[model samples]
Target: MITIEGVDAGYGRLQILFSVSMKARSGEITAILGPNGSGKSTLLKTIFGQTSVYNGSIKLDGVELSGRPPHEIARLGIAYLPQINNLFTDLTVRENLLMSGYMLSEEERRKRTEEVFQLFPFLRNMLHRKAASLSGGERQMLSIGMALMRRPKVIMLDEPTANLSPKMVNTVLDVVRRLRDDHGFTVLLAEQSVVKALRLSDHAVLLVGGRVLFEGDPSELLNNKELGRMYLGLGGG
Candidate 1:
């Protein structure tokens, strides 16, 4: 559903992604796995129009997204969730969700909220609570739920498991998998958690120094300890 070719992006004169090319199929989870500062996040930001792309093309369902603004790209069915500072901590959970549906009608907003509530049932009880008081897991759930308000065809998540408990991480991964399997949402997840990301993904891309080192089925990385260690920065099986 999405295709990127020779994409390069960075701040000012410092380029972070180097001729990075990749693709995400519809209704499948495609993971971008790499160590810190490998430009995985920049690739996502470029696709979402958060970062400037000096060169190459990012096509979503055959339309070029390179020069489009973020909102315009969003209207084209792309949703991005960055790693940190994802939610409004002072607002109530319901209010935060309402913000995502600003473009929808009142009835549509309520219906979408109900749909999101089904994904994170924990929010159903805490609708009135301020986001600041919610646990890390709950905050992540809120962030994801907000993104889903528009029912995007493509979703990009950056380091979703960062700073979360193991149990919460599992819960979040389960939701990601369910989105692909049950809802036909295309997923592009950039994560530092190699093992878990690979386990949940239908395909994986390994990046090092802003370059794609490997792109293939997840089992290829999982079954080969040496390749995982060398390319993914893992030391052992």
Candidate 2:
């Protein structure tokens, strides 16, 4: 499980999270829902060691993640997939997966690559295609396929469905579901699509202005007429 207790973090001197505390239980989908500047992205970044955490702890399965470098954190089984620039656009899809698994032996890379292909079979045929040449949905598939190479215990996805067509949104989200359901991977999803997110999440954390407004069952936030209408823009809440 990923645990955060009294975390205060941000870039340099500017703090975005304020005494943020929450627990993302293992093998479940934890939705981080909020408005644009409410620090959803910052919260994920804080856990991944991208932000400066002035106070509190970020622990994954009892290991302290604070003060660790990004690569070290990654090595420890926390894989972060940000909203943008998630892949090497200059490289081919095959090359991108290769780069993601550089730490593994060539034989292991081949094995994982096949596993990725099993999840995104379309990628198997597009191995030589440059990441920049794929469609938005296809690129996202490749990007996520790369993350899967590590076989991480936890995957922190920052708006995995962003900038995709409506159909593609569901497509990407289905993969998010499989991450928890099929692979038993813990998922931390930060999303702006409130209702859709709530529907998929097993647990939910509502953030407003960098603080936890609500943290409990997904249904609690979805059923709350006031908070739904006021903060989440859920119509007729």
Candidate 3:
């Protein structure tokens, strides 16, 4: 499990999160839903060690990760996929996956690469294709596959469905679900597609101006008409 307690973080001299706290349970999808400038991305960056934590603690299964660097955090079984530039566009799909697991032995790299290919079978055929040649959805898939090469326990994705067709949105969400159901990964997704994300997630965190206004089962957010309307722009259920 990933836990954040009283976390205050942001870019240097520009704090975005305000003592925020939340928990992403093991083998479950936790959706962080909020409006623009609400510090959703900043929170993920803080967890990944891209942002500075002015106060509080972040832990994964009892190990303190508050002051660690991003690479160290990744080594601690946390994988972060930002909204863009997550893939090496000029590299072949196979090369990108290989680079993601460069620290592993050749045998382990090959084994993990095959596992990722199993998760995204379409990439098996496009092994030699440069990442830039793929469609938006396929690029996203490849980005995720690269992240999966390390087989981290927690995968944090910032806007996985951004700027995609509806079909692709569903495809990405389905993969997120599979990461939990089939692979036992703890998935943390920050998404703008609130309704869709809420439908697919087990828990939801509603953020506004860097504060967590609500955190509980998605059904609780969906059923609260006022909270839904105020934060999510959803009509009364």
Candidate 4:
């Protein structure tokens, strides 16, 4: 499991996350829900070592991760996909996947690429196409495929469904579910779609002003009339 306890982190001296504590359990989806500036992305970045951590601890299965660099954190089987700039826009889909696993042997890289293709069959057909040419949903698919190439135990996705059609949103969220349910991968999703994300999530963390306002069962958050309507944009039922 990925555990965070009293983690204060941000870019340089600017502190965004204030004593953030949470757990992303294995084989389950943990939805990081919040308003636009609620620090959802910061929490994910803090865990991935992108931001400076001032206090507390971040541990993956009991190993300290706060002081480690991003590459070192990634080598620990954690793949973090930020909201933007996740893909090499100039590179072909196949090339991006190859780049993700360059440290592996040639044969192993090919094998892993095939595994990613099996999970996302459409990627094989679009291997020659540049990532810049693909749609939002397609880019997300390619991004996830590239992450899978490295075989990560934990996947942190920052709005995987951003800027996509409604249908594409569902499609991407389904794949996120599969990563947890079928592949037994731990997923920490920071999403903009509140209802869809909560419905699919096993656990929910509601962040407001860089603090944990709520954290627990998804159902509880869904049923919260005040919070749902006030901040989450969920209509009264």
Candidate 5:
């Protein structure tokens, strides 16, 4: 449902992504795996309009999105949950959820908040608590829950499992899988943890030096020792 073609994006006068192209299909969990500085996050930002796309095009459901603002992208059913600084730490859990739906009407906001709470019941009990007081895992859950408050068609998560405990990581991945299987939401996840990401994804894209090194089912990556060792530093054997 999302297509990025030959996208080049970077900070002012400094390019990070170079002609990267990929597609995330509806009803699939596509994982973007790469080592640090591989321009994986840049690809997401360029698609979401957070970075300027100097060349090529990003299309959501067949409409071009190159010059649109980030909020416009959001309104088109794309939600981006970045690796860090996604929420207002000082805001209460309920307040944060409320903020995510500010673009919707009051009745729509309440409806969406209930839907998010259904996905993450733990947040329901902590509605009055400050976001900063929650544990790291809880914070991450909150971030994802807030993104769900928008009722997006495509949810793009950048390193959702990053800094959580092992159990928490499993919890987050379980939620993501359920989001795809049960809720039918299209998921595009960018992660550095190849093994965990592959375990949860339906498809994989390997990126290096701001380009698509490989793109296919996870088995292609998990079965290739040479590719894994060369790009990801994992012995794959």
Candidate 6:
């Protein structure tokens, strides 16, 4: 399990997260839900070591990861996919996957690439196509495929579905679910589509102004009429 305890982090001198604490249990999807500017992305960045932590601890299993650099953290089986700039737009689909697995041996890289291709079969046909030429959904898939190349134990995604079509959104969500069900990856994602995210996630954390308002089963947030409508903008089902 990935544990965050009393984590205070931000960029430069600007603090965004305040004593934040949460747990992303193994083999489950932990959805980070919040409004705009609520520090949702910053929390993910902190976990990935993109932002500095002023206090507290971040651990994977029993290993402390707070002061470690991003690459070091990634080597510890944690992979982070930022909301944008996650893909090498100028590179071919296959090249992007190869770049992500540079640390592996040549045979291992080839083997992992084939494994990710199995997860995203459409990418198999687009191996030679430049990433910039793909549609929004296709680009998202390629970005995820790159992360999967690492064979990470925990996958963190910042808005895997931001501006895709409804069909593409479902496709992305399905892939997220399969990553856990089929591959046994621990998934943590900051999502904008609250209703869809809640439905897909095993647990949810509601953040407002950098503080956690709720953390438990997604249904608790969805079932709370006042909190849902006021904070989450969720309507009655």
Give the Å shift of residue 14 in candidate 5. Answer: 0.9
Q: Candidate 5: global Cα-lDDT?
A: 0.88
Worst 10 residues of 5 by lDDT: 228-237
Q: Judge candidate 3 at residue 71 and give its lDDT.
A: 93
lDDT of 1: 0.89
lDDT of 4 by residue, 38-94 (tens): 999999988988889999999999999999999999999899999999999999988
Q: For residues 1-237, what per-residue lDDT tens digits would candidate 1 score against the true structure?
A: 888899888877788999998888888999998878888888888898988788999999899999999999999999999888888898999999999888899999999999998888889999999999998888888999999999999999998888888898998888889889888899999987788898899988888899888888998977778778876766684
Candidate 1: 10-residue stretch with minimal lDDT: 228-237
Q: With candidate 5 superimposed using the best TM-score fit, by how many Å does residue 202's alpha carbon deviate from the native?
A: 1.5
Estimate the TM-score of every prediction. 0.96, 0.98, 0.97, 0.98, 0.96, 0.98
lDDT of 2 by residue, 33-59 (tens): 987899999999999999999999999
What does candidate 6's lDDT look like per residue over 1-237, in tens digits? 999999999999899999899999999999999999999999999999999899999999989999999999999999999999999999999889989999899999989998988888888899999999999999998999999988899999999999999999999999999999999999998999899999999999999999998999998888989879878888766
lDDT-sorted candidate list, best first: 6, 4, 3, 2, 1, 5
Worst 10 residues of 4 by lDDT: 227-236
Error of 6 at 171 (Å): 0.4
In Å, residue 122's CA in model 2 sits off its true spot by: 0.6
Q: Give the TM-score of candidate 2.
A: 0.98
Model 5 Cα lDDT, one tens digit per residue, 1-237? 988888888877788888888888998999998889998888888878888678998898899998999989988999999989999999999999888888889998888888888889888899999999999889988999999888889999999888888898898899999999989999999987678888888888898888898888888888888888898777745
* Clash pairs for candidate 5: none
Better of 2 and 5 by TM-score: 2
